[model samples]
Target: MHLKIRHRTEYRYETPVRYSIQELRLTPPQVEGQCVDQWKVSTPIKASTSHDVFGNLCSVFAQESAYTSMMIEAEGEVHTQDAYEFIDAPKAVSPYHLLQQTNLTEPSAEMLEFFAASLPQKNTIEEVLKLAKAVQEAILYFPGQTNFATTAAQSFIMKSGVCQDHAHIMLGLCRASGIPARYVSGYFFAEESPNLASHAWIDFCLDIDKGIWISVDITHACLIDARHIRLAIGRDYYSAAPVKGVRSGGGGEALSASISIAKII
Candidate 1:
């Protein structure tokens, strides 16, 4: 399957920004299960500077205008490729591990207990699938209840959250169980679905002899397919935000974004 994507983000500031620096992780990497035939990003505002942490950036400073718009348009052809063998991406080498090490906090005792019980028993793919499904059934998908900063234990205790929360809870459990897991930020298409939104999920390294990192979307209760377009992978949302930045300005700021995607038949 092939896909084409268009994403646009606009910013209107109440006060003129003296200077701003931003990091973008919008470009999708060509991975084992996906092939990028062609890709490009166009920004209306010429970037003062940019580099690849994974995406493009447009750094601006001292704009005289009070309102500004930053637009990024990307078009690409991506094909579904065959799955690769799952390799042991330990915490030491795994990107997620590196992220966790930098940000340390205490894990809940209840979460630790759950990890102890779940990891040892999940020796087969079927067992892992069952656990993921259980999480889906146990949690309700409510958007406004949780934000990107919400953690796994909190979501588990609340029994409700958006996709990010679900992914975090699931990823934490998998990692605590000694399985290598990472967060996936992506987009999903459901034929003619009007309410398209950014999606999140988890990819866990399989224990089978072949070694595969199978993706499990607890929110959808299914394996990711052609409609899925990956942006970045990390421990959680902070590392994978489509756009992150810092501005040298005081006063309130607001942001708005719009994304559009079309599939070629």
Candidate 2:
């Protein structure tokens, strides 16, 4: 399948920002079954591109001058295979590195006990999807109830969150079970609504020595299909966030992001 995608983020500040720098993981990588045909990023200033430790294509840009607003946009075309799982090549970071829990993915003691028996003994697709099903059932998909900083434990206690929360919960459980799982941040082409375009999922390593992984969309309770476009992946959301930045003087900022995915015939 071929897809055209555009993502735009805008920030308006009540006060001028004297200096700001942004790190973007918006560019998708050409993995086993995914190919990045063409891609471009638009920013207020020239951006430098490089790869991060996780092997994600990243771009960095800085604005030194005072500014009241800023915009960053990434647009691209990609072709993907219909397969749900693929063997990713080895990276600078070992799959074992993902087993380390981050603040966002650390599970509560209650969560660990709740999923203790259900955690997959073998990292098989069938067994993992069962875990995904249990996660989706346990956590209702309710937006606005949680934010990016929400932890897996918090969301599990609340019993509701969006796709990010679902992915984090899955990550926490999988790692606790001694499975290597990474957070996948990407675009999911939904025929139903544009609001669902921005999505999150998980890929648990089946054979770490061979870099084999099964990608699962916990929110949907299924393996990733062609509709899923790969982006940056990391231990948790903070590492894989499409846009992350710091500013010296921006105050009371209003931020908006838009994502669009269209399937090409």
Candidate 3:
């Protein structure tokens, strides 16, 4: 399937900003079944592009002049496969490296207990799906209950969060079980609501030797289909956030984001 994606982020500051630099992982990678037909990032200044350690396309831009607001937009067309599994090619980092847990993805004792009790056997695709279903049921999708920095343990305690939290919780569980899993940031074409286009999921390594992985949408408790567009992969949301930056000024900032994904017929 072909998809057209547009993402725009705006930031308004109560005070003038002096200097700022932003790192973007907005560009999608060309994987086995996914192709980036066209992509671009629009910023106030020229941006330099490079690949990150995880092989994600990175775009960086800095603004030096004082400004009250900043706007960044990315638009593109992509082709995706209807297949559920995604076999990622081995990059500079080894899949085993993902076993190490970050603060955001660390599983709590209760989470480990839940995993042990709920899933006592090996993790086949079906078993993983079962785990995903359990996760969705355990954590009700309650928006505004969590933020970007919320950890898997915290959300598990609350029993509610959005997609990001769901992904983090899944990552924590998989990694704790000795399964290699990574966070995926991307766009989901939700027919029900355009506001739910920006999405997050997980890719657990099915076979490390062959770079085999399966993409699962934890919130939906299912494998990713053509409606999913790949963006970036990382150990946690902080590493794969579409937009992250540091600013010298820009106090009391108000931020807004708009994302749209449409079928290209």
Q: Which candidate is the best by lDDT?
A: 2
Clashes (candidate 3): 0
lDDT of each: 0.63, 0.91, 0.88
For all predicted structures, in order, the TM-scores are 0.78, 0.96, 0.96
Best-to-worst TM-score order: 2, 3, 1
Residue range 1-265, candidate 1, lDDT tens digits: 6777667666666666666666566677766667877877665445454433423232332333333444555566777643533343332244335224112112467755654544437645666667677678767988788766677778777889878877877776666666666677877766575344578887777743334577778787677766777777666677667766776553566666666666667
lDDT tens digits, residue span 1-265, model 2: 8989999999999999999999999988887668999999999999998988888888999899999999999999999877666676555578889899999999999998888777998878888999999999999999899999999999999999999999999999999989999999999988796887999999999988888788999999999988888898899999999999999997899999999888999
Best by TM-score: 2
How many clashing residue pairs appear in each of the predictions shown? Answer: 3, 0, 0
In order of lDDT, best first, we have 2, 3, 1
Winner on TM-score between 1 and 2 is 2
* Per-residue lDDT of candidate 3, residues 1-265 (tens digit): 8888999999999999999999999998887668889999998889999999998999998899999988999999999887667776545468899888999999899888876755525757887888889899999998899999999999999999999999999988888778888999999997787766999999988888887889899999999987888889999999999999999987899999999888897
Screening candidate 1 with a backbone cut-off below 3 angstroms (N, C-alpha, C), the clashing residue pairs are 18-62, 86-211, 86-212
What RMSD, rounded to one decimal, does every model reach?
4.4, 1.2, 1.3
Worst 10 residues of 1 by lDDT: 98-107
